[model samples]
Target: SLALGPSGAWSRCAPAAATRRRSDSDAVGRQAGMFPETMSVFGNRWAAALLVAAFLETTRFTDFQTQLGAPPSLLAERLQTFCAIGVLSSSPAERSGSERSTYLLTDKGRALFPVLVAALQWAQQWFRAPEGPAIALTHRGCGAGFTGELACDRCTELLAGAQISVVAR
Candidate 1:
């Protein structure tokens, strides 16, 4: 087991091999719609942090902590987990006077942004909203608000949630 400083946190310094195994499992779990188990590595706070980070022009550890309202260590741990998952790319800042590293969304991360947006739309439709959505999405072609509804390609009609079926193996 690798040691993470002197904290004696067993989970903090998992063996590299074990970490790889866990990452694989998490990927599978995410595909299976069992993201709760997968998300245990980063948890809700970190997930929120990642979502917040995606909105920014530049993502850094400090920016993540500030946006998520999380502690420094927690943010660091979450960012590391996200990088391991191939969702976020991290690189040392190129310019001088930059102490912290910068993060960017990988292609996979950008694809997941729509999923997050859909989830938020569902939440806003079903749950009580204290305030409106932070950002509004619009269709550039029509300059109209983009509705988060999915429609049948053939029928051109709104698809009901129950109409869709998933056959899990």
Candidate 2:
């Protein structure tokens, strides 16, 4: 017979050493490449939105500037820079009268959304809400509200600040 701890009683339990080792290796690999090289590209709201808008749908230069309330020249400059970086593909619209160019996210830009989500979640935790959350996530299956809380992927527990460490070389 085995003694149960204060948490609860369980049947037989076996520690899986091999599985744990593999998971640890995977975590290390991710951490090694965690920080991005082109932080300047995502430093402003318009740049971030350029990526987000592309992710949401195909957008024209004028429409993007209108949506973000940014100047047309600035929007054009950022779009050109993003295209240069291979984050977005920009080309003239097919319509003959269309003066605006369309922007679409490449695979690389789509991948940055999760990082943006994490940043938003962190902001929500530390910043005061004037009204409420800017956006809310709902679970499609269960209809439960999902606040983007950073948690340990393995333990399914919220991570403490001290537990997080970053290394760059």
Candidate 3:
């Protein structure tokens, strides 16, 4: 487990194994963890933008390219990757029997909504917004500005850094 310190840095709270030594097997074990794999999904410069665009209902390939200004090859590659991972489903376009296809987010992709919201909230706090936030979100249900919150699923209690722990099994 890791704990956030006063300086806002995370440090391992669990005691280290005294006799453990680094090895190739240890590196392989770490690679198999979900954290690295998840990061790889969003590590590219345009990945988050592309995913967010999909969330916003931009389906056509041309629209995605126009909105993101992404290179054609890279955009196609990313879309294919998303499809291969079950994050998105591609289907024939419904417009006038066009040959183009549309991409839609699957359940697995929709599950990332909160993660994106959390990321936007974090950016608002840590980054400069001299002209105000680049994107202002409002919740349709409440008719109020959205402020992303993290809460416990079981207890419905609000959660903070100190209350959370990452346990390695």
Candidate 4:
């Protein structure tokens, strides 16, 4: 097994031999023994958009539909996928009875916040907007604008791609 060195910055784990894609595959690859890498849980672009909405506490079906302008079918599929993967929990909106269901992020889902934050940071840095970022997150305790920092979990130091090294199993 390839060790992550506590930082998990191993870009070399990318599916180097992956070629033209096919349909309905867990991953778009034929690389042998490609498991246990940085697999994208929500591979769909819309999935990320929906996850951002969920992080902001929007859980109702209608809310997701309205906010995302996604078709009912696609949205339903993604939501079901998230629930099936234990990333989101679905429950009745009403304790007694309700026609609608509500979605909540599970602990596993909440763990994706760091990944989301890092992606947002990268996007903000590269994709500049004329009016600045659409959202600016502030640290509650520190009271300062916050952005994700890529750090080494073992050494507790900031990381760059150049500082990372990947090993093959």
- Total backbone collisions, model 1: 0
- Give the per-residue lDDT digits (tens) of candidate 1, residues 1-169: 1111233222221221212222233353355445654464345434643553454444777665554455565456566766766677898988888776988878867766656667656744665334544445656677777757778889988888799888978
Q: Which stretches of candidate 1 lie over 4 Å from their true place?
A: 1-43, 140-143, 152-157
Model 3 Cα lDDT, one tens digit per residue, 38-157: 654565556677787787688999998776666677778778767766678999989886999999999989988888778866875786345555455677777777677899999989
lDDT of 2 by residue, 69-138 (tens): 5566666666776776667887788999877677887787777767766765675567635555544545
Native-to-model Cα distance after best TM-score fit, residue 165 in candidate 3, in Å: 2.4
Least lDDT summed over 10 consecutive residues: which range in candidate 2? 9-18
lDDT at position 135, candidate 1:
44
Judged by TM-score, which candidate is best?
3
Winning model by lDDT: 3
Give candidate 4's root-mean-square deviation (CA, Å). Answer: 10.3
2 or 4: which has the higher lDDT? Answer: 4
Which rank order by TM-score, best down to worst?
3, 4, 1, 2
The list of candidate 3 runs beyond 4 A from truth reads 1-37
| Model 1 TM-score, all chains together | 0.65
As for TM-score, the candidate ahead, 1 or 4, is 4
Off by over 4 Å in 4: 1-40
